[model samples]
Target: MITRYDSNNRYSKAVVAGGFVFLAGLTAEDCSLGIEEQTASVLKQIDDYLERAGSSKEKMVSVNIWLTSMSYAGGMNKVWESWVAPGIVPARATVESKLATPDTLIEIMVQAII
Candidate 1:
């Protein structure tokens, strides 16, 4: 069975199935925000989704991160490292790409098992 949460006209923020959750790419609502603030917002969204899906960021198995500006990677990584679990950090891949939202600097999507 599949279940979706926090859906809107554009996308369902997260979906769960077979005891796992797949979260949509998360970006800050206010694109004008700097990388640090944007990263904070993204992490908060991830936290909320994981909680609703019976999991947590610490339980994330993998994450796909995209930064519109490659130069911002270092900044984003700093925030990511702070949120990632110390001993059980998830596998992650970070890449540079143009985001759908012009001002968005970063986007993160995650997969986790409850």
Candidate 2:
């Protein structure tokens, strides 16, 4: 059976099914932060949800990151490289896209197994 968590008016923050947890695109609570800060914040949020779902970054299988501008890639990656599990990092793709708001720098979605 499938389990959903953190449901809001727009979406469910996570859905657990078939031994996997899928996280919705997470953005920083403080949109005023820079790319590095935003990425870090987003990762931490993901971590919290993962823990709640009995999983962690080390168990992640895939990730999709959207950046408002390619110029922020370097900044975002710096924080990501440090936060990711040491070995066998999840497959990830980073793309430049127009976010919902001008101040929003990034959004990240994660998938992991229990």
Candidate 3:
């Protein structure tokens, strides 16, 4: 069985199948914010989506994080460190890359179990 959430013509914000939920890359709605603010906002969005998908941060299996530049990683990590509990942290990879927009500082993708 499969399920989709927050779908639009372009793509679903998340898809659930085979007992796992796969989320699309998400960026803060207000990209003009700094890295810490953007990361915090995106983390909140992740929490909301996880709940809607019948999971939580503790269920997250993997996370892929992208930052517009390596310089912003510290600020982003600060926010990430606070939101994620120590033991429940998911397998994650953070990389420097160009984002969808110049203003967008970071983007995150996640996978979680049902």
Candidate 4:
């Protein structure tokens, strides 16, 4: 069975199905922040969502990150490395893409075991 949380008109913020929890792409609330701060904010949000889904970062199986510019990758990585569960790093990919908003520098989506 599938269970969803934080639903809105557009989509659910997270969904649990097939023993996994999938989170929608999340961005920092304050888009004015720099890459590092935005990355940190997004990670924190991920942690909260994972916990609410009965999982944690250590249970993550995959992650997809998008940056508005590749130049911000280094800063994004620094925060990612620090936030990821040590020794249980999940499969991850980072790519440059145009985000939904001009001020948004980064977005992250994740899948974790429930």
TM-score of each: 0.94, 0.97, 0.97, 0.97
TM-score of 2: 0.97
Measured with C-alpha atoms, the lDDT of residue 59 in candidate 2 is 96
**Whole-model lDDT for model 2 versus the true structure?**
0.95
The candidate 3 region of ten consecutive residues with least summed lDDT is: 81-90
lDDT of 1 by residue, 7-47 (tens): 99988999999999999999997889999889989999999
Clashing residue pairs, candidate 3? none
Q: Give one digit per residue, the lDDT tens place, for model 3 in 43-90.
A: 999999989989899999899999989999889989999999789888
Candidate 3, residue 6: how far the Cα is off, in Å: 1.2
The global C-alpha lDDT for each of the candidates, from Candidate 1 onward, is: 0.92, 0.95, 0.93, 0.94
Instruction: State candidate 4's TM-score.
Output: 0.97
Task: Please write out the lDDT profile of model 4 over residues 24-82, one tens digit for every residue.
Answer: 99999899999999999999999999999999999999999999999999999898888
| Off by more than 4 A, model 1 | none
| Residue 100 shift from truth in candidate 1, angstroms | 1.0
34-88: candidate 2 lDDT, tens digit per residue: 9999999999999999999999999999999999999999999999999997886
